[model samples]
Target chain A: MQKIVPNISVDCVIFGFDFKQLNVLLVERKLQDEKTGETLIDDWTLTGYHIFEDEDFDTAAARILKGLSGLDNIYLEQFYAFGKVSRVDSPKDNIWLKHQHEGFSSRIVTVGYYSLIDNSTVTLQLQERNVKWFSITDLPELGFDHQEILNKALEKLRSKLRSEPIGFELLPEKFTLSQLQKLYEAILGTTYDRRNFRKKVLQMKYIIPLNEKQKAVKHKPAQLFIFSRDVYERTKRERFDFSI
Target chain B: MQKIVPNISVDCVIFGFDFKQLNVLLVERKLQDEKTGETLIDDWTLTGYHIFEDEDFDTAAARILKGLSGLDNIYLEQFYAFGKVSRVDSPKDNIWLKHQHEGFSSRIVTVGYYSLIDNSTVTLQLQERNVKWFSITDLPELGFDHQEILNKALEKLRSKLRSEPIGFELLPEKFTLSQLQKLYEAILGTTYDRRNFRKKVLQMKYIIPLNEKQKAVKHKPAQLFIFSRDVYERTKRERFDFSI
Candidate 1:
């Protein structure tokens, strides 16, 4: 067996958006209480694993998330490193850590990574009944410092969305401007003037206009648009225009 | 001695600006070779130490720099995690590690932190003839993966300066407008039109104008200003304006 690096692990905060609400993927662990002989709190955590010796940190993050999203090349951006000595607070957490690795402690520092993906298109392999999606606002009791990790991830995502055109990763190929505005509102936890938002974004040449519109909606269909990667990549080298 | 964490370390990229150029602190290690009975590369490395079992990563980073800077409250921001199997490629590194702790391997994950400080005020304590500052552009051969760590720290610093008002940390209590512009140009590696730069920044409410200018300059003196911390703190919660 490969000798895993002692006292180190990688955790990922995978964010998913369905054009309306933001969600994150979390894993539940099974641990037993010694006195009662009963299953303890099913603590939820960001899906992660101990990194192997051969791969770099980026590759290790992707390795933990390989078969879950169905898509192979997920962009995982490392944001922060959580290194509180007491991150794994309770006795139950230590038991869970033992379950993952014999003679283990979650005192390890975790390199935090986050990515936004389209929720409807990919197949989410939950791995038995453990992994599930919880609303960003309604998270359950988390294990370790995973809650702190999630908040930092959200802060990073908000900052990233303000600077880059990464918000397109969360939406479908073609989306209405209203849907785009709502996506930003969800992530930023704020409201925007629809007319002003439309005016500013419409002036940008990168958000290409599409021919199709919503088919089954009751109200009049708004025009669809797609983010132009060719222009985004080229102009990304030049200067930023689409900022919050 | 307290048990140091196995296979884990904290490295700091202590960036100091002396008005003209950016400099980083590095330490040189001396070790004799086993076979030829000669000294090795005299490798330069970031001033770092192994994490204590009970200490958090930030505390560990601050602890390493505290003795060197002679300042107890060294703010160390965790930026990146460097995890590579071959990070300690040279035989000399392994030998040095063994000297520090028996049965030591370089398969360690190092958490990277960078901090900016004004060079003139603080007295830097160089351990032996070992620690010294070199210009960021003119770095020499570094030990292990320190050069890579330095590069990553610079990248993070640039991005951070673009979004936040962190550039003030490098400046004195008060500075001329030209000094501020030069700081940006130095960090970004690009020149900005003087008139446009001043006009844009003067419009900002946070850059408070002071009743002072250059005292002993031969040329015409420029007016000085200070970044208002109250305004910066209040506005930091809002959207960002100072960006690239």
Candidate 2:
């Protein structure tokens, strides 16, 4: 028997960028009436599970993410904790949750953990649970206050992106500056002056320009640049800010 | 019959500054032998409690702070959550905790909340709890992973002090640039070039200079300046970064 903390859970909000739009990984859950064989609830929710008795919150979040993506050492962060009393009180979620957990009748305080991933980097292996990535702007009606959780995670991501180098987590190892700008625009939901944005970002010494360009494209291949973590680590005194 | 969540708690690390040093608010707990009436254990810990089932994490933190300080609308933020399996398993803390609660036998995951206050602003009224301010550098042995929690909160405060104007939370409404510099030095545990520090901070338009001067001082009194949140709010687009 798997012992778990019945009143606490860790919800992992995996955000991925496919070089176009920002998306979040969610799982589809469908509950059917046992006696009448009718669909009672069919909705999407964040990937989460009750934390094990022996696991800390971070460990629980990592375990859940690793189980879904089969990847290790992803950039995971615990952003917020959602503990609204009526968060899980919806009749549909209450009925659906009964089919999932053995004893989950009480309120659950879920620690919200999020990560940014380049969609091509990881091989998602939870198709059996119907895990799919939904564009952040066109999200379905999520269950159990997960929409609020995702919004909070996006807000945090936006704030961190302004002062941190976390936006590279959503890009390939070698990316063009246009790709970087697009990723920022998608997450922040705003457009930036191309010249101004590039001027400010290129000043950061850590964005090392590689003597390389795109392989194949319809337009002119822009120069490629790699975010040098080594350079950043060496000169960590410099604050990474691109509020332009 | 005060019902609470037995396995979840909120710990508040209240940080205050008195223009000389940074301090943390702590409460003392003592355990005594039942028959002999001899003291078994005595130690300091953060002000916290097992959360009520009806309360959210932020609400619980604010309630605990208000109950202790009798102050409303102080700056409070949820920093991190400490959920180690052995966090509350210390034999000494376990013995002392038994007297405080009816059933706290299981592992408790505590969400760490922190706040900054000007020592002169609030009237602390928890004399009976042996609540006192201790300098961060010279702290007593804290109980049950609280030392680790305090260390983490200090680290967060240091990082925030670098990029945000949260340092103003520790000063009086009208303060000199020298006082602001001293507050930053005390929190970041370093000294700065006086000329450079003032030059950088003076450029921030939000720090408005008033036609006022300090009074009742032995030496030459400096000019007084107030942190204009109105100006900050009006031109909030400018990122507040004081890495100098």
Candidate 3:
């Protein structure tokens, strides 16, 4: 008797900020069929992979990140598990479908994980076809239900931003209050009173003022601030509400 | 070229309270060997299933609960994803291996979900095997990493208990302050100051004192209280710190 097993995989939508817009890492589908000579070169999606029989889910996520982006020790969080049976389009008509076996179907259950990385530090090799970063707001139609996955990740990110100091991960090590406010505004997709935002952020005491200021902006250079890791660690143990 | 596809599955651990202790639903695993005519009887595990290729994970979870427990619309939440290779111990050296094909390997990734059900309303049937409720504290050695999954679910339960009005799910529709307090103590594993606990709960203003009292208690007949759903829904939308 053949034992039936469920296949598991992990997908990650890495988000970063370029001081103006939110961007996500995406890769073009590389697998193609030679017999029919068809390709899905334009269908881009998040970096994902199958969970090997022996690997743990978190380990599989880290391994996928390492394999695709060549980055390690990045903070990765499990967001949602996508288990809609037909999330992937049918392979029968898909050029990529010819690459798979006949009896097997595209029944993928993927756990979505999101990571925040500094885009400047990332060295894009384009090793896996057309791997690139696209503005999240202007993303093209994704291959699978990746657009939905990305939206869910953004919601998680917004909720996380309220309680945790995760926004720092999307910005540079040293940044200005305006930059921080802009990042929050972009993520929340709402306008905030600048004075109130600064006041609230200052009250949290998670950010420390640096002596340096932003140098290249056309307007008045804003004072730079760095996230106080020690302060964040200490305050995290205490219950503080940052709902607003 | 062979195309690789992933299979998806959902596993649920339903929890209930029996006034004295916390319990979890388990199903017996029946193993029979064709070669030696041997059988391993009464092996118990969580209720699980392979999600059809086109079903949503949440939908599959609801279906599994309805199929196994004949219950729906219960308080369910996703806890963790288990993707460890070799999670299922092979019985290759056992008598059952003789009936199975060689070089056959099964890799399964199971997402763990949990539901809080009223113990009194749980109607059990020996659908698959011997279904029984075991005290969570004294659960039998479960298959694979189910024990770990249960622990994570309990942690999530505890966290949700502090933030939401989930204790009502574990208790009767009408309950006393002491019963409510005991439920919290059981879930949190900590003894609370009786006066302080009552005061804090009262301050939340989401519990309504009913026009009745417990009749058969050993001590004073405590005033019955019911969670005010309207108040809870309203308060949940606002930011309230439940750190203490």
Q: Which digits, one per residue and each the tens of the lDDT, describe model 2 over residues B1-244?
A: 5588888899999999888799999998877789999988889999998898899888899989999888878898888888788888788987877777668847889999898888967757565678889999899988889999999899777766655678888888999988988888788788778898777767778999999999998999999999877777776573522221
True contacts kept of 2: 0.25
* Per-model TM-score versus the true fold: 0.89, 0.89, 0.74
Model 3 chain B worst lDDT run, 10 consecutive residues: B92-101
lDDT score of residue A239 within candidate 1: 45
What is candidate 1's lDDT per residue for B1-244, written digit by digit as tens? 8888777889989988776778888887777667997886587888877888899988888888887887776556788888877887777777677777754545777889997777757757675647778888788789888989999999888877777787878778788878888777777777888998888788777899998887888999989899887876766455632111
Task: Report the Cα RMSD per candidate.
Answer: 3.3, 3.3, 6.1
Number of the top candidate by DockQ? 1
What ranking of all candidate models by DockQ puts the best one first? 1, 2, 3
Better of 1 and 2 by lDDT: 2
Docking class of 2: acceptable
> How does the DockQ of candidate 3 come out?
0.26
Cα displacement (angstroms), candidate 1, residue B184, comes to 1.3
- Place model 1 in a CAPRI quality band: acceptable
What is the iRMS for every candidate structure?
5.1, 5.6, 5.6
lDDT of 1: 0.79
Top lDDT prediction, candidate number: 2
Runs of candidate 2 with Cα error greater than 4 angstroms are A32-39, A123-127, A190-205, A209-213, A238-244, B32-40, B98-101, B121-127, B190-205, B238-244
